[model samples]
Target: MMMNMFFYMGLVSLIVLTLNSKHLLLMLMSLEFLVVYIYFGLFIMMIYMNYEYYFGMIFLTMSVCEGTLGLSILVSLIRSYGNDYFQSFNILW
Candidate 1:
């Protein structure tokens, strides 16, 4: 009960952190945190439900791929702009 509440609160806080962040790196980090939290939630659910997690495992793999892709993009952006701050990215305008 209390553990679930704390888990949900952490998720909400991670979402707020991602939304309120101004730096690309911070936002990306928050997104990664969100992914990890989701994975943990799914893991707990699987334990209690005692069910096969084919979809969950697939989703986790996809999430890991997505994170790595995002990191690669961030690397390129940093290389081009010399910083990970959104304000530093002027290619959009």
Candidate 2:
């Protein structure tokens, strides 16, 4: 039941992430959704295994740090480039 729902949601987010690769914001959003789905899946596994939640907390902390890092990078890029479009930036510099 819930497992199927999570699987479908993860799949959808992956599709969105793939289809919207040109827009940084959209890619970030879908990646965030995928992270959230994994977090929930971890929560469900912990509940079933009767395990401590310390690992989950650590994972959540890491995920938050990852998101903040990504946002900061995005902000720096937008500040210099004026937009979040990948086509607007160059890698050869």
Candidate 3:
């Protein structure tokens, strides 16, 4: 129960940080934090449920793919804009 509370608090803080951040890099980092926290929760649930290892492996693979894609996008954005600030993104405008 105590561990769960800590996990929830960490998740909530990461969510708030992601929402409130003004820089794209920080947002991406927060997103990674969220993904990691979710994965951790899933792993714990899987262990309690006695689930198969393949499912966890698949989830890890997907998470890595997503994280890599996010990082690539971040690098491209930084190269194009010279900074990671959110306000500089005016594509929709």
| Best model per TM-score | 2
Best by the lDDT measure: 2
- The segments of candidate 3 whose C-alpha lies over 4 angstroms from its true place after superposition are none
Q: Please, what are the lDDT tens digits per residue for candidate 1 over residues 28-73?
A: 7777777777787787789899989897989888998989998999
Off by over 4 Å in 2: none
Write candidate 2's Cα lDDT for 1-93 as tens digits: 877888899999999998998988888889999999999989989999999999999999999999999899899989998989977889524
Residue 58 displacement in candidate 2 (angstroms): 0.4
TM-score versus the correct structure, for each prediction? 0.76, 0.93, 0.81
lDDT of each: 0.81, 0.91, 0.80
What is the alpha-carbon RMSD of candidate 1 to the true structure? 2.5
Q: Return the lDDT, model 3, position 65.
A: 94
Question: Mind sharing the TM-score for model 2?
Answer: 0.93
lDDT of 3 by residue, 57-90 (tens): 8888998998899889889888998988888878
- Which is superior by TM-score, 1 or 2? 2
Residue 92, model 1, lDDT: 57
Predicted structure 3, TM vs. truth: 0.81
Ranking of all candidate structures by their TM-score, best first: 2, 3, 1
